[model samples]
Target: MAADGPGKKKHGVLFDVDGTLIDSSYFHAMAWWQAFRREGLDIEMSAIHRRVGMGGDKLIQSLVPDCTEDMQEELKAGHSAVFSTFWPSLRTFDSVRDLLAACSDAGLAVGLASSAQERDLEVSRHLLDAASSIDAWTSSNDAKESKPAPDILEACLEKLGLGPEDVVFVGDAVWDVKAGAAIGVPVIALTCGGISEAELRDAGAAEVYDNPRHLLEHLESSMIGKLMTGSLDA
Candidate 1:
């Protein structure tokens, strides 16, 4: 079932793929761990997990603080290689398909916008079942600047022929919040990808939930639904 309506116009919802809709945060961490090892850095998986949603370039820079540009390039390449190997094992969370169905049935246009590379985004698209349901998508290659920059979200909005006011950006990372906020798109944060509610709120998320299933459960009365239906303040 689609989430409840607020008796107004419905808006599009842009989703983050990795940690928000799918359970790939730790898998990403594992891949990063292996990738870092290839470059002789032995970082802990737990440490990497905490920074999962940071874009790949930023992630390598953060995890391996002292690296030449060439080394960063190597790490990025290595991480991609390791991560691609694990794609076969990637999995989606429970009820994720149902949530996507509900959004589609509710007449909302859904977009997938992530900082992941185009190939990785494709992998995620298939894994999340977003291939059939997503109305539009923006991969890392789509924008010159990555998350925390509004370019990516703005690109999605532009591609969809929708304005910032016509969409809500749902993500599990602080970068996602900052990007959406900068573009004046309302953001709904989910903690499923390992971002904390406090962090999400502090980053400017309009509302926060544990996961999509939880949001689905309260679809009608939630801030996102109200905003989508045009019953809430901009």
Candidate 2:
């Protein structure tokens, strides 16, 4: 909530919430499915799952592009309404708070670079309970486009007041890799979001992990860890 004033950290770490730090990917997909179902649209759950990390509008556009503009808005709102019902079911991944603390202690600005709604983000932050470790965060208000557009990542950069070279993004989706790549920020991909390691690498991820706990366990060897410690090689 406070600005990174004088003598603040130089390097930063941007993290995605859903499926990366939290275990809500499948729930999100189910919410989208229910929303589409209400419109008499029978979208496959697997299809919705593939677009879970991105915002609702982008997800609806990607999966149901044939719908009218008004229909798109309706579906998006429906998805939000449905997703809200499952907020109480949200849980943080193991060692999520530790990972944020590790970066913060290493003198890196910790940021949440998610396109989630503000209220949802607040819920996630409360779930993590690592406000002391966080330096900057983003909500849907900060970016219009979702993953693969680089807008969300760009907003995080602005929040941290750092350039792409000073940050390493951590996420669980290939769209995250693509967005980071678009802005020259290296990505550390996690496979717990239903994405394969090979697919993440193919999408330009510089490193990969199974989950937040795995990355935290191997912090010294991960790109984010190295970046935080000022040991990353040019």
Candidate 3:
């Protein structure tokens, strides 16, 4: 990460990896579904998908509140093992690289604030292949708390030496909107992660778009664009 010159306030965008930049939400839901099945829990895929942005512990607890600690650990391991098999098929969303590049080219710092495990994050990052435009990134290991708690976002902000007021977060889940709200950051929501635009708006998203391509096309009028043009306070 590069330091801003004296008195310069750094501005940037923090992106959620899964579902936002990468098309792995359903894969994750499936993995969790299989993990639950392994435990004889029989969790529905829809229930798992809605909690995809959360860390494994939280996701397991949310879907199976009575799950024992040992069972939670087992489920996490199970999910990880199952999810790893999908690595070969994981892919970045349309124009994900181009969107990141546009943010970088507009003189903004770019950071990935992901709640994924370190190894999983690495795989997704590899799929993104736009690392040159990224200034910093965070994994599940980087935060003490997860999405809907804002710890990962805070960790990313710290890594970039920026404050919530200086950055906008982009994500595809209601949990992401909630996380951004916790720290007073505006969240730009995308529906590509299987979330509905109405639900994203209902969660208090500053704006909603279809995907990276949709957002990139309307960048000049979006919150990110306002940040780049100095119309939105950093």
Using lDDT, give the best candidate's number: 3
Assess each prediction's global lDDT (C-alpha) against the native: 0.78, 0.87, 0.90
For model 3, residues 77-168, the per-residue Cα lDDT tens digits are 99999999999989899999999999988888898999899899888888988877888898888889777899999988988888999999
Q: Tell how far residue 50 is off in model 2, in angstroms.
A: 0.8
Model 2: which residue pairs collide? none
Q: In terms of TM-score, how similar is model 1 to the real structure?
A: 0.89
True lDDT of residue 129, candidate 2: 94
Model 1 worst lDDT run, 10 consecutive residues = 1-10
Worst 10 residues of 3 by lDDT: 1-10
Off by over 4 Å in 3: 1-9
Q: If the candidates were sorted by their lDDT against the true structure, best first, what order would they fall in?
A: 3, 2, 1
Better of 2 and 3 by lDDT: 3
Q: Which residue pairs in candidate 3 have backbone atoms (N, alpha carbon, C) closer than 3 angstroms, thus clashing?
A: none
User: In candidate 2, what are the lDDT values of residues 58-119, reduced to their tens digit?
Assistant: 78888877879999988888888998999999999989999999988888888899888888
Question: 135, model 3: CA deviation in Å?
Answer: 0.0
Better of 1 and 2 by lDDT: 2
| Residue 131 C-alpha lDDT in model 3 | 72
